[model samples]
Target: MSDQESSTSTSQTEGEVEGELDEEVDTEMEGEGEHDSKHRDSPPLQISSFSSTLRAVIRIKQKYHALKKRRQEAEGDGALTGATGRTSPKIFTFDGTTPIALSVPQKKKRKRRRRVMYPNRGKRRAPPKPARSRAKYCLYLLFAIVFVQVYNAIENLDDHLLRYDLEGLDKTLRREVFGQQGAVEGLLSHLKEYLSTYVHNKPWCCPCTAPAGVGKSHLGRLLAGHFRSVVETLVLQYYVLHHCPQEADALQCARDLSALISEIVERAEEEEKIPLFIFDEAEHMHGEILDVLLQLVSSEQTNEYLNAIYLFLSNLGHSHITKHMLHNSSSTSMAKSGRYSHFVKELTPILRNTLEKLHVLWTEADILPLGLLEKGQVMECFLDEMTREGFYPDHTNIERLAGEIEYYPEVGGHEYSQTGCKQVVAKVNLL
Candidate 1:
C-alpha cells in the first residue's frame, strides 16, 4: 500500500477503537447508575466492579502504543523502498508540521591519480660542440704532399751525385796532388755543385794558369786519369803542342777538334753523363781552334753542349803569377788563406785581360792560378817519390834530395822552390 494511504487507514482504525472504548465506558457507567439505585442495600459489590473497570482501561492504552510503534516502522520501510541496505534516516520536524528525512551520504570511490616521471631534471644542459673546418684538413694534406715531393727531389739529387764518385775524387785529389789545397778546394766545389744535377745552362770552363814545372801538367794528367777511371771513354786529354803543333794545321785542327767535342757532348747527353775535356798547353792553340772551343762552351749553344767540363792548362800568365807569389811571400795574410786563392783573387782579372788580347774564348773561363811551391812542399814531394821507388829514405836523405833542387831569393828564410816538384821524380830515380 502507498505510505500516505496506509497512514490514513491506520489513523481511521485508531479512531474507531477509541469510539468502541467510549461506548463500552458509557454502558458500564449506565449499569453502575442502575446498580447504585439497587445496590444502596449492597455497597461492597459495587466497589469491586469499579476497580475491574480501571484495569480494563489500562490494557487498552498499552495496546494502542504498541500499534503506533509498528505503524512508524512500516512508514520508514515504505520511504526507503527503492534504496535498500541503507541506514534508517533520522526524523527532523519542520515548523511542527511534517518530518524531514536526511539519509547518510555515501563516500565516492576515489580514482587513483597517475604519477608523472620527468627525465634529467634540475641539472643544467651543455651546448652542442662545433665541428672541425674542412680548410684545416686540406692545409695539412697539402703540407704532407709538399714534404714528400721535396724529400723525393733530394733523393734523386743524391742518386745523380753517386755516378760521379765525388768522395773518391776528393780523396784522390787531396792524397796524390799536394801543395795546391786552394786549387783542389775550388775545383771540387764546382764539380760537386755541377754533378749534383744533370740539367745545365752552360759548360764549366776552368783555365789553370801557372809557371812551367809547377805541376800544371801534372794536375791536368791527374784529372784526366780520375775522370777516365770513372767515366771510361768520355774523358778527352787534348794537347795543343802534340795535336796541332803547326800553324798550317790550324784549319784541320779546328775541324777535328770541333767534331771530337760535338761527338763527346752528343754522346754524354744521350747517356745523361758529364764529359771532361782537358786541353794541355792551351796558350799554343790556334785562333781557329780557339774559335771552335769558344762556340762549344758558349751559353748560347744547344742544351747538349752545356754538360761538359773544360780544363785549360796553360803557361800564359806564368810570369805574373810567379811575380805575385814572390812579392806576397813575406806577407802573413796570403799564407793564412792559402796562396792559390790569393793568386786567383788578385790575378784573375789580370789573366783575363791578357787572354782577351789574344782571344775572347778565354775571357769567360774560370781562372784558377797555381802559386809557387814552398820549400817544405818540395821536400814532401821528394819523400813521396822516394817511397814510390821502393826506397825507405830517412828525413836526412829527404832533406838532401830537396836541397838539390833550386830555390829563389836565396837569402830569404821563406824560399820557394824554383822548379816545384818537377825534378823530384828524376832525382829520386837517381837515388
Candidate 2:
C-alpha cells in the first residue's frame, strides 16, 4: 500500500483501539480514587496526549452531560475536538491498564446574601478569550478555522450528492427544477440535450450574451453550491433593481462597475467561466461601465471558461428616467423593437444617435420576449415564499373575500378583474 494509504489505515485502526480502551477506562475510572491512580501510572507523554484529549473531552462532557457517555466516546475517538463535542466521539488510546475519566474543577455555588455583602461579585464580566500563550493560541485558532471550513465543505458536498438534504434557494428548486418528477424535471433532464444545440450561434460574436435572468443567475448560484457544477451563482445585485445609483450617482457607478466585473472575472477559475453577465440595474450603471462590459462580453478571450458563466439581471423598469431620456430607443425593452413616435424628443443629436445605434445593436433579433407574470403566478410566488417561512395562505378566507367583493358592484366596477383583487379594490369609486 502507498505510504498515505498505510498511514490512513493505521490511524483508523488506532482510532478503533483507542475507542475501546476509552470505554474500558471510563468504566474503571468513574470514581475519584481510580482516576488519580490511572493518571499517576500513565507515562508523561501518554499523560500529556490523554490530558490534551481529556481537557477537550471534559469540556464536551460538561456540555453534553445528558449524553455524557456518547460525547466522551467521540472525544476519545478524537471526533469531538470542538463544537461536535456536544456529541464528541472518543478513541480508546491505551496501554491497557484500564480507562480513566479525569476529574475537572467543580463550579462554586452562589451564596444567598452575596449581592448584599459583595455587590459586584458576579457583576464583573470576564473579557473575550482569556489571556493565553499568544502564538500557540493564535495557531490553534487558525487551525480550528481551517478545520471547520474543510469539514463544512465536505458536509456540503455530501448534502449536495444526496440532494434531499439540499438547503437554501437551490434546495427548493431541486425538487421542482432538477427533481426526478419535478415541475421542470423535463427541462433539467433535457437540458444536456438542449445545451449541445443551445444559443450563441449568431454570426456576430461580439456579445454571445443571452438575456440576463434568462435563468442564468439562478442556474449559476445553484451550480456553485451543488455537486454537479462549480460555484455557479452569479452575484447579480446590480440587475435586480433597475434603478441603481439615482441621478448624480449614475454616471460614476456605470463607469466603475467595469473594475468590479474585472475583479470578479479574474478571481473566478477559468474552467468555471461565466458566459453571461447579469447587470440587473443597467439603468443605474455609468455609461462607461456599460461600454467596458460590452467590450468584455464581446471579447473572444472571455468566453472559453467552460465552468463559469456571466449573468446580468435588470428590472428593465423605466420609472426613474426623464421623459426625453425615455424617448431614446435604448430606454425601451429589447423585446419591443419597432420605432416609437415618442423617441424623436431628444435635445442632443449626438446622444440621440448614440442611443439609437446601441438600441438597434443590442436588441437586434436576439432579444427574448418579456414574459410578465400573471396575477395568479405572482400570488403563487408570494404564497410559496410565505409557505417556506411557515405562513400558509388561507384559500377559503381569500375566496370568501373575493365573493363578497364581487357581490358589491361599487367595490371596483365592471372592470374590477383587470385591476386585480388587492385590499384597496373595495375602496375605488373612480366612476
Best TM-score among the predictions, by candidate number = 1
Candidate 1 per-residue C-alpha lDDT over 208-281 given as tens digits, one digit per residue, 9 for 90 to 100: 88877768898888888888888888999999999999999999999998999899888898899999999999
Give the distance in Å from residue 65's predicted Cα in candidate 2 to where it truly belongs.
99
Model 2 scores worst on lDDT over the 10 consecutive residues at 407-416
Clashes found in each candidate (C-alpha, N, C closer than 3 A): 0, 56
RMSD of each: 22.3, 43.5
- Cα error of candidate 1 at position 199, Å: 1.2
Clashes of 2: 56
Quick one: how many clashes does candidate 1 have? 0
- Candidate 2 lDDT at 112 equals 65
Return the clash pairs for model 1, or none. Answer: none
